[model samples]
Target chain A: MSSSFDPSKYPELKNLLCSIDKIPDVSDIRPETVTEKVIECNSNCPDPRLKTLLDNLTIHLHDFIRENNVTTEEWMATVHYLTDVGKKCTGSRQEFVLLSDIFGIAALVNSINNPSVNGSTVATLLGPFYTGEFHDIEEGGTIAPAEGPGEPLLVTGRILNTSGEPIPNAAIETWEADAEGLYDVQYSTYSEPDHRGRFRSNDKGEYSFRCIVPIAYAIPDDGPVGDLLIKLGRHPYRPAHLHMKIEAPPVYETLVTALYPRGDLFSKSDAVFGVKTPLIVDFELIESDEEAKAKGFKKGPFRRLDYDFTLATKEESAQAKEKLRKSMAKKA
Target chain B: MSSSFDPSKYPELKNLLCSIDKIPDVSDIRPETVTEKVIECNSNCPDPRLKTLLDNLTIHLHDFIRENNVTTEEWMATVHYLTDVGKKCTGSRQEFVLLSDIFGIAALVNSINNPSVNGSTVATLLGPFYTGEFHDIEEGGTIAPAEGPGEPLLVTGRILNTSGEPIPNAAIETWEADAEGLYDVQYSTYSEPDHRGRFRSNDKGEYSFRCIVPIAYAIPDDGPVGDLLIKLGRHPYRPAHLHMKIEAPPVYETLVTALYPRGDLFSKSDAVFGVKTPLIVDFELIESDEEAKAKGFKKGPFRRLDYDFTLATKEESAQAKEKLRKSMAKKA
Candidate 1:
């Protein structure tokens, strides 16, 4: 045998040698290999649930990259956009949450985690403006201190269980934009407790408040999220709606939902994807002055809406509570 | 005929009325519907390329969410992590680039953009620390300012074409970590021109530099990226190597690459996935003071490495240039 081996004598070796200088396909990422490496790295994660979550996330993310064959420039642009979204987030603004809302992720997650029970109200996005605190108002009192625009309206609702029995003293938090399509938070010279209030249902589970009928309003669009919406040729307008957080006794799962007017132009095309058909109600027009006065309304031509909210059973509520607790605990 | 006729006679109508009050699945986000809406929003984008990019991105992102069924908590955690990563970025630090590197995206992009041509040296990641400025030194000069603890190293290299012809006057920029395994950028007390320099090949396309041998070093692990590495059960160590950017006249595509020492602990498992087998070179040991002195060194023990870099033809170089130009134009 020769001390030195010659590759020229072997056709297979020659072919391999010839390929040594060949140019590789630029977009070839070897996604399978990359996915395996990522999974291996996360294999020893201390939390099994977290490991599973990361594993699934990695698989999905890698699959997306491979499926799209995303180029370097496209990936960098995404990074820049995401960074801008983060940088835009402040104490009063959360662009990421806004992004989630627009993508329907928030609504989807809310629905998935809190399945409806019987005829209980369905939960929706909590939204970013919830302050967890509102000025208390007497039953059937006016939530709006000074109405700037839109039609005068009266909203009356009852909180009950699936059995059609009233739940006395249920706490209700409600807020909506004025006729000018501006939330109290959006006003530069605004004060606390204007066009927003918290009220409690009476022993009969009847609650009422007076305000201007809500109108379609655009979300704040000066930030990165707004830019994205504009790029997508999508309007930022949400349908005319009222946000409410109802907490009744015996059901620990709080119901955070919005009630949309049935005839709003954007009712079926809410920018935030926060609308549901069941949550839509008609703002009935009441023109009889005498009947309006009997209902404690001083004037005629006011819109009236009556909606009844049902709470889920205690067992159902408990299951939702457990699920939320587990999900929250997984973060730690 | 009575207006209220029929419901009593039609059992099916009665059943439909009863079921109308049933609670719906609140979190029911039809991903297909959402995807379609998003696509519709971007239908009028001024830039067709942007429209395509956004379309693909939205599809992939939505698919990932639906496939993984990511929970609200998990999504929030991801948001928080990305926000932190952005917040940590400073003028001298770029966490996102590090993330891309660790994920093998950087290497993939570099390889894709700059494919090897006729045995020309393959390009690797430019890395985050490359500032595009290096102090020019004469040929056969030392890059290291002071000898540290590691063995002395003498590196000699030639710049040539695929046809084995010398390509004289090739500008080469080289950098490496010191004996303490710290790049100048990583040291708190570091100054300029330490363990890094720029030089040119002579008439025969030969160049030489003296320095301390490099050792494996851990990447910056004091930030969010570091935290993620620990959580993923991965070490942040990069294999011992020397970085170089070689550019010759008429070749617009500057080759950015690195040469690794054989047998490094992390050679086979570089944290950034940047190591390529062809880039590894053996360091021959010399143990005679007379021999070292003959090479203009006064030391007894020294390691020597000799490697040749080949440049591609004009056509191959032009292709890379066009690709990069197109990529850059997209950003603007």
Candidate 2:
């Protein structure tokens, strides 16, 4: 223990300066050997998995500095930027997620963990908006508020297994932005959750909910992440998409994914990299008043989306994730 | 501009969503191609230098993630950890700098920026203790308070140019921790600074001051950085050292460095990677009452540190830095 470590001086910290017999002393550090010294410093981590992650992180972080010849000024500026990013976090906003999203790291992690399995519906980003606070509604009920701000859309989908059989009682939660491309959570008027709902698949595996048409929306642009995007000369627009999460648990691996609307300008360059080829769908415009009335809409010309989600069993998904990871490692 | 970007909704953001004609739309992103996509997202950065840095950053960061197969949970954990680190910063404390120091990045940056030139002194980490707030003191005056802690020590050094000529009137600032290994800035009782002083070299390039001997100190251990050190199996102790900054700007580059005492256990592995072999010095113990009283100490036995610093002219130092950076790049 450092003799100077007074418990009263650092009440927040645990007295962890015990025997370091497991840690090896490092040699003198120079530019050429500092990375090695740092690596050896981390070699005493008890968790082997965490140790590997930190080791790789150090290797890449140091390499970035050396390759770019990054100056102290540039590094300090990055530190300030990151500090601003952290300060911008709130209950409804996550600037760090936006940071990862803009860099496509979130997409890459999604791809790595949710690799394709047995023709199941491809998964995408969970985004930064899922609050998991929606009240459960009956099938065919409306998730949109009674006085919502957009054209009504009816989303109906059947949950099926890879072998083409119904998977009943699966929970599905969905959320989206209003006509102004703003989520309820993004508004000052937001009190209770809006434009979101939870429902369960019936015995026939059918699910339906009424919602406003999702529009292209910008990720929060008043934060450090937005500043970074602007500095990179990129737009902050994500294509129109509906966020969905379905879970059967124990038997089925929960599917966290989204569906993007086709023909959106930003679909080709969704700021968050949440778009995948298979996840894109077209909404058919139904202009029949009789059908609209049956669907509890006051008028016609509402959008209609009919799709089916194929889910992979837990065992199948585990196998696919391991196989893909091993294959990627082999390729590397 | 994104059509969904409403100015009223995001009043904090400048209306920066302009034409991205310079930004080419990216293709479909997959695990294998997300890195390429993200890199191209930054291709439109106007500053070519910044663009290169971002490109290289994307390459290395993505490589780290893919090579390690970082999962969403692990990535989110990292995000939260960074947020905590940022939140821990204050007027006196810089958690980010500590983060860099422990990883040896601060040392690497210091090494890269201040490469040796013509037998001039090598530099090390400036550390997080410097406040640049010391009051001026006459040569041979005591910097320690009348009722300070620890044994007395006398520090005398000469400032010289590379050719061994005296560099008169160079301003030198020095500071150190108390016997308890804590700086005045770290204490609740601290108001006016103690144990630090600023002085100028005389015509003979001689500078001297009296201070209490600095003891090995632990970096702030109540924060996220201390928690990280414990997890990494490393100690937070830096060797006992006196921090110094000598400036003769315009003619010579300012030098910010420290002198480590020999025989300290942590000297070989300074927690912040600030130790350099050349900067380690032996403090001679003198038991002569006449000499001790002559140095204005209250007692006989006292420690004396006599070390001279050699500096390079600004032009010489700049050339050396550029040469080292280029050579490092070539080696990489």
Candidate 3:
């Protein structure tokens, strides 16, 4: 779009040339109005659900800017920090997930998606450590390979329906850190997924795995998220817990959850806010050499955990999913 | 920090144990309470201003999540997109600055820092194109160097104080795109800052330079911010304008701003919202070879701009700075 101008030389035209559109007299629009307009514009998004979600997000973001009166320099700094978090993510590490976990967003999402049904296991955060490439272990086989370091502990559980019936052939996927508080994938000494495996429920709806009891550990702190935690004066340790994802055929939905050892120091202050009462279990000491020998162990004493996980009927799961969808779709 | 359990009979524990301080059971806190605690925890930030800003930001971010009921997948997607923007940044390109520009944040900051003072020239955004490395050019000399493309034009102005007295020897830094709407720095063909330079005012506070009349151009839209603008159905074109940053000795403060051509299509709708009423000027057609010769131009039929910029008193500038600092210092 070109400015209107005459190429012809004329004394009268000279005076008019300098006066054309010379003043930007447009009224200033408030930043608040601009934010509202942005939200309105996104309302036409193809996906109604996504539009609602984005609209709310935009509003909160703008509100935050206004409330904080954020400066240009501060804003740029935040943008840079977020970029760092993204760049820090790798196949083995998910910084964004860590951010979500520390902020309690992961737990919120879990609760929203998997409401506690009468007798079902209380869902907790899946955390940033699940590799999903777990090998299938024979019933009661050791998931913590001989090479990994941790006290021998056995985890046994039963999968059952709300009606108290056994959910035969259910898959129970499990993973945990070594005694030193490092997940198998986090080790520089190993390249493969260690101390993580899946086991099938027996005809009696029973599943068990030999692994080390997880120790309380700090989330990765060498990144931007860690820097933020330090700045906020928040500790980064999560209570010792075992990550699990269980699934059964048509009767139940996939459940991603975790179980924490009872009485952990960081339990009340779990850094990621992923702890739940029902998910915490007490480990009992067993000192039978005969039992260890029968279980194919060359050792005597072991810590044993016996917990049963309950699943909701498919209808209950569908209801929870629908509830979450509706809640996420709330229009501004 | 070791778990209080026997290790003698457990020979396996002796070899594998690593002092597990394992326990995780404690009463659960609601996510809402967690957010509140996070905000409260920041009350001890050494810098009150930073603490307030962070608190407000955290509140809004958490509110956005709660209000939108953002799903895990959506949150992860946003994290990924932000990371992409950071990765796209380099020495030559600042995607974050471009983002701030598109969101109208840069304009808001400029306006906040430099409110209109009596006759002072209005300040606009110092866009990402400014490399901060401007070469000094002699009065009436061409700033296009020898290789850029555009029709010849001349800009002449006087720097004056609010009382209308000339401010001699002031430095005026100028930059803009060529006829093709590409800034010198935006072109790979030119490795240095071309079509951009600084010039000093003469004895009577007069300044002049030879350059191509700037054309309307789009901000870089090959990144996430551009994608956002597209998604928001917003145009990315900025009005044709010449960027300038003028500074004088003690009595006057530095001014970073731009002057727009009258009647440009984007004058009223500048992409970054950098346009203001007093910053637009008109260009007069100069058709006399004799007059062009007198003005140190080798060509006729060139455009000439005649304008004077006014500066604020030092007292006014100091007040603004103090106000900004105080505003940025509010805690809790």
Best candidate per DockQ, number? 2
Best by lDDT: 2
Query: Per-residue alpha-carbon lDDT of model 1 for A1-332, expressed as tens digits?
Result: 00112335333234432442231212123334655665654554557766776676666555555554455677778767777787777656677788877766666566555556667887676776775657788877777763345677889989888788988888899987776677776666756756788988899989888877777777777888888766554556677778889887566456788888876666555667777788888888899998777666676878899999888866876676566446545632
Q: Which of 2 and 3 is ahead in TM-score?
A: 2
Looking at model 1 chain B, which ten-residue stretch has the lowest summed lDDT?
A: B1-10
RMSD of 2: 3.2
Classify candidate 2 by CAPRI docking class. acceptable
User: Model 3, which residues run further than 4 Å from truth?
Assistant: A2-27, A40-51, A184-190, A249-251, A318-332, B1-27, B184-190, B248-253, B293-297, B313-332
RMSD of each: 12.8, 3.2, 8.1
- Determine the TM-score of chain B of model 1: 0.82
lDDT of 2 by residue, A79-162 (tens): 778778878887788888889888888888889989878889999989888888896788888888755678788999899999
- Kindly report which residue stretches of model 2 are placed more than 4 angstroms away from their true locations once superposed: A1-27, B1-3, B6-23, B188-190, B288-290, B298-300
User: What is candidate 1's fraction of native contacts?
Assistant: 0.15
- Name the candidate, 1 or 2, with the larger lDDT value: 2
Worst lDDT 10-window in candidate 1 chain A = A20-29
Clashing residue pairs for model 3 = A24-B277, A264-B23, A264-B24
Return the TM-score for each candidate structure.
Answer: 0.75, 0.93, 0.83
lDDT of each candidate versus the true structure:
0.69, 0.82, 0.72
* Span of ten consecutive residues with least summed lDDT in model 2 chain B: B10-19
